[model samples]
Target: MSWLTIARWDARAVLRDRWFISVAGAFGSLVIAAALVALGSVDVLGVSAFGRVAATLIHLGMLFIPLIGLTVGAVWIAGERESGSLVLLLSQPVERRTVFSAKYLGVAWGMTGAVAVGFGAAGLLLALRAGTDRIPAFLWLVVLSSLLALAMLATGFLISAGSPSRSRALGTALLVWLALVIVSDLGILGTAMILRLPAWAVLVLGSLNPVSAFRLAAIVGITGSADLTGPVGLYAADRLGFAGLLGALVLILAAWTGGAYLLGRKRFLEAVEG
Candidate 1:
């Protein structure tokens, strides 16, 4: 079958999965909760009303997006292999690379749909409650969040490819999620504290990680000033400029997502169809 055909099938399957609704609902609830919470708060360091909620949601997005993206991706190939579905699909005339590409494309679209609902709902609510002016910034945050989700999903593919079974793949995915969270935070802190790297150097190193890059970019959206993100932000704002920082963050995110997916696909081919 053609790649498009396979991708359509996989997208449909992923979107229709039982957990999909729950995922969407979780995002909606988070937005509503954050909106209500923002109303009670006095100030988020002088950020606009929408900015306050957006800032809170950015952190929540960082946590939720990666978890959902990685977990769903981790289960994808591993579950298929464990269930013997991969073998059945392989029996078709399609090439293994085609299968991998199609599967990822399909799943990416499925996930995009779910995340759009979540982020979109937040934007809509903010527009109604806050105003339409900052909608552009929130929309930009949505784009960055989508990229971050894709990056995590790509990492999950590597986990699923290397793993021999679904449970192991899922477990590995969780450990990986925790490692990235811990390492990205402590790792940055350690670099600054132990290495005594210059602020510019530390900011550059921090953006190397997709999650960090996303957070840094989101900071601009929330605060309209990267300097508010702390010293790293201050350094980047002075040395790199906002345009430079955005360009660098986008490039880093693209590299992580593309590099991880290609590497994972190669491993899957060797392991499953070698």
Candidate 2:
């Protein structure tokens, strides 16, 4: 079968998966709740209520999207291997790379759809409550959030390809998620306290992780929350300018997705050949 067929099959499988449904539901609920809560507060004459909601949603996206993306991606290939479906698929005329690419696209699109539904619901609510001017900011939030999800999904695929079992792949994916989401921040805080890290150093270190890069980009680029991002944000804004920093963030996320896909494809091929 062709890669498109494989992608379609996998997409259908994702739709049937209970875990995906639960995660997507949770994401949507959270976004809707955030919008309602933000609206409860009074909007100042100049301040945009949609902007506040979008900022809150960005933080929420940072937490939720990566976890969901990783879970979906980790199971894509490893689950097939566990069920002996990978072998059957390989027996077909499809190239290994095609299979891998198809799986990635399927998972990526599935996760992106989930995110869009959640965030779109929130955006619609915001548009109703706030002015239409906020639509552009909401759109930017959607694009950046999708980019972050794809990056995390790529990392999950890498873990799945390298793991021998579905369980191991899942365990590794969780660990990777924890490292990027929690441990990395703690380490940076501790190191900064101990070493009195320079602003440039903090920016450099933060940009290394996709999650952190997403946060930096959202806060600095979309929300204009330079104060919240601290000196690192200022450094980025000063050196790279807002447009340049955004360009760099996009490049970093793209690199994460592309590099992980290439590496994962190689490992998947090796596993099938062996």
Candidate 3:
């Protein structure tokens, strides 16, 4: 079968999976709750009501989107291998690269759609209560959040491909998620505090993780809150400018996704052949 066919098959499976369904449902609920909280807290501040909501969503997205993406992707290939389905698929005429590419596309699209739906609900709420001035920022948040999910999916897929079993893959994925989402930020904060890291060092540390990059981009781009980021955000804004910093974030995400895909593809091929 062609890659498109494989992608469709994978997407269908994801849609039918109850785990994904539950996650999507919960995420939508959370998004709606965030919207209500933002609306309730709106005041005559320097920032617009919509900006505050967008900021809230950005923080939520930075944490939860990657988690969902990684969870969805962690068992993708390794689960198939564990079930002996990978062998059957390999026995078919489909090329290995095509399979990997299609699976990646399917997972990425599924996660992206989930993020869009969740965030779209929040956006509609903002538009109804606060007007459309922040619509552009909301759109940016959706796009960036989707990209972050895709980046995390790629990372999880790489772990899945390299793992020997589905359970191991899932474990590794969780560890990777913890490292990127929690440990990395804590380490950076501690290093900056203890070592008196320079602004450039802090900026570099923040840029190292895809999730951190997403947060930096969202705070700087959507909320225009450079001070909230402390040294790293100011350094980036001063040196790269807003547009340049955005470009850099895009590049960083691209590297994470592309690099992970390449590594995963190599490992998958090796696993199949060996």
lDDT of 3 by residue, 23-112 (tens): 777877887897888787565542366666776787778778777778778888988989998888888899998899999898787778
lDDT of candidate 1 over 1-274, digit per residue (tens):
5999998998899877765557656865887789667744524433367767877888887778888778888889999999999999999999989988898888888888778877787777777766687788888888998898889889988888877899999899888888676577787888689978887778877878788888888887556778668888778877878888788888888899999899999999998767
TM-score between candidate 1 and the true structure: 0.92
**TM-score for model 2?**
0.94
Better of 1 and 3 by TM-score: 3
Off by over 4 Å in 3: 41-47
Structure candidate 2, residue pairs in collision: none
TM-score of each model, in listed order: 0.92, 0.94, 0.94
Better candidate number, 1 or 3, judged by lDDT: 3
Using lDDT as the measure, what is the rank order of every candidate, best first?
2, 3, 1
Quantify all predictions' global Cα lDDT against the true fold. 0.81, 0.84, 0.83
> Per-residue lDDT for 1-274 in model 2, tens only?
5999988888788877888789878888989998988876626533366667877898788888888888878987898889898889899998889999998888788888888888888888777777677677778889889999899988889989968788998888888889989899889878987999987887878888899988887777666546667777778888988889888988898899999989999998888886
Candidate 1 global CA lDDT score: 0.81
Superposed Cα deviation of residue 234, candidate 3 (Å):
0.3
* Alpha-carbon shift of residue 226 in model 1 (angstroms): 1.2
In terms of lDDT, model 2 sits at 0.84
